[model samples]
Target: EKKDKKDKKEKKRSREENGAAPKCADEKPAKETRVEGAQAAGDVAARKAFLKEHRMTMEGNGVETFFPCYTFAEAKFPAQANEAIQNYAKPTPIQAVSWPVIRAGRDIIGVAETGSGKTMGFALPSLPHILGAKQKLPKVVVLAPTRELAMQTSVEYERLKVNQVCLYGGAPKGDQIKALRTNPDVVIATPGRLIDLCDSGLCDLSQVSYAVLDEADRMLDTGFEEPVRKILGMVNKKRQMLMFTATWPDSVERLASSFLRDPIKLTVGSTELTANVRVKQTVEMIQQYDKDKRLLALLKEYKVGDNSRVIIFVLYKKDAPKVEGLLKGRGYTVGALHGDSSQAMREATIAQFRKGEIPIMVATDVAARGLDIDDIEHVINYSMPLTIEDYIHRIGRTARAGKTGTAHSFFMHPADKNLGWHTAKVLRDAGQPVPPELEKYGPPAVKQVEKTCNISEMAPAPKITFDDSDSD
Candidate 1:
């Protein structure tokens, strides 16, 4: 017995010296047990405390064995990937806990609001996971809702020295086919375009072992459910799936049950529809006809002509160009991002906005979901979105990367009354003052409106109709 114990100790030391990955205390299956550094078995109390402090609720078969990391060093990713992660001051709450679970080779369902550094949370783990696979066999595939988000995810993988090919609608298909011939390690694509390529026999997902569904809720909401399901069906059966969403809805729950196997659900904050607390929300009850003047006044009040960046969110594609023309006529350097813009135009506009050359951008909900520019100082809602969920995502564009921002909304009665109660609840939850005009649309006010209109109940809010042409 003494000789056997000595031999095991020497083996462990040798493995450590050679930088082999560590296994969880209670080992799982072959691919489902490797973690970064060995977690301290006695740190159960501290791990529980960390989860509680972040308001993170996690539950699954092997979730209790997971622990949180305060720094990237604890993640101990391969040296090539470690350098990029170390550049950040510290991991965001979602990234901190998700990395440990992901590195342990478990499928995870991350429920966190936008601008929570979710991209890096999943991107960082791809390095170590792909290192063990065959050379350029397409080990990883990330399905995003929009082309902008797909490109953003590709940029993250590029930073980690991972060769990637982006497949989206708008770009030249010939160029994409050529890149695919190179057998890139990663493919970040939109569902529709990816399916098209697969049907054409130019791309193969047979060897894809790591798959990610980024912005999955948006994919379902935008009428891409069939495409998403078809693409998932083509990938390897033994793959690990990772899904991240801003809200936890029944639709997402059903989809998760269908594809994921014994997954861990991690919710960083409340599952209710809530905007980022760092944003200061202000509602102005004004006339619909006077909105153009009010927008100009708000622009002057916020001094957007200065170095700060601002995004003006409109409701429709037709309105995006009009708003852009209005801002440009007033001598403001501006750009427009919508479904109507060509791929090159969208890319150039986003690049200029990121560089601060174009300080103001007129955009619709297409820019709302996963557009991650961290320096936006303000958000001006030119019109109320059809749903409160979209309103939260619009404002989420600002106040990113630990910075505070302001959001101004023009609320016109009869047009926006459907969202009055919903808007007030979001304001109250964030501790922002609720205006009396907007407050009257609460439950009691709903009754008042029903009584005056002589109706049994108010009609539900109008549903948002998305364009099916641009799947991204």
Candidate 2:
């Protein structure tokens, strides 16, 4: 009896040293006491400090138990998935904190900045989740907002050696249908095309147990909310839902409440809408007619032809081709990307841009979200977008992956003033100088209500400027 007792104690010690929980009935009380003590003191303080240092905010139940991984080994991902990420020494803040929560089969709403490694954060966990399923017939579904994002997502997942297919509207449906028949383990798709396939009996989502809505805010902004809702309704009711977005809005909150069950919300940075601070933003107030000339001047200053890649964002499809022609006529090689471009042309242009064959591309908001090209030195807003949200996404094309870049905008008042009001505040928040002309369009002051008023009879709007230091 003495020898048996000693052996049991040794086994318990070995398990504890390996970071496993004690299985012996007699050892449970001691282990519980130690964990409770740590949780009440050192553990809580250390977790709080770590989250503060990384600018992370976590909410909801089960978040206090969340532990972050610094190195790839600490994450303890499956051997197959680990092999694909061997080149990455450490996970990003989003990726680091998400592994444990997601692997535990908890639904999550992740809000992080763009280029923050959100794709890998969710993808790594899905690999093991899908592998554990009994039969793989589209066990995982990732719905991206754009075709480029969907294709890029598929590329990332394929690296894990998982059989996957990408579905989008701009491409040929025949090929997608053929691939769908093969019973892929994962389906990376856009909402429109995926809905079309489901309606026609080409795709079956009934067996899908995992669904990811990548860039959920953008998806809703682009009029895909109804289709996304329909797609989610088609999936299995007992599914795990992962919703990730760069910004969190009321619309997303409503959607989350409807679908996710007790999801843990993880935010890596501030939830307020703000541009990437790494991009130096400059608003050049000019007449609408002077924009064409000013664009050329700015390009020359940036040395675009000397191996500098720049993206010029326009507000309309009609302007994309015209801007492309203007650049080509000026002895510069350029490509145009807009809603009207065929899928083949869009892919070809992106391929050329990636290979350095075309150093400049004039594009619309369609290109703003998901072009994976690196080293984009500058982003020029030839025509300011209608909303400040769009402006943030356009400028986000630059200043990626720890590299500093610049965004220059040709701001025309009266036409762009509505958006300029919020834009100025965004600039001030980033420590960038807000042009005085654009600053004058701030919100109006409250005045006595008039029974009847003419357009010219109203009082001039109050001039406002945001000073972060003065804001308490």
Predicted structure with the largest lDDT when compared to the true one? 1
For model 1, residues 394-462, the per-residue Cα lDDT tens digits are 999989887899999999888888899999999998899999987777453422221122111122222
Worst 10 residues of 2 by lDDT: 455-464
- Against the hidden reference, what TM-scores do the models get? 0.85, 0.84
> Clash number for model 1?
0
Candidate 1, which segments miss by more than 4 Å at Cα? 1-38, 442-472
Q: Which residue ranges in model 2 land beyond 4 Å of their true spot?
A: 1-46, 444-472
- Backbone collision count in every prediction? 0, 0
Question: Model-by-model lDDT, in order?
Answer: 0.82, 0.81
Model 2 CA lDDT for position 356: 82
Error (Å) of candidate 2 at residue 150 is 1.0
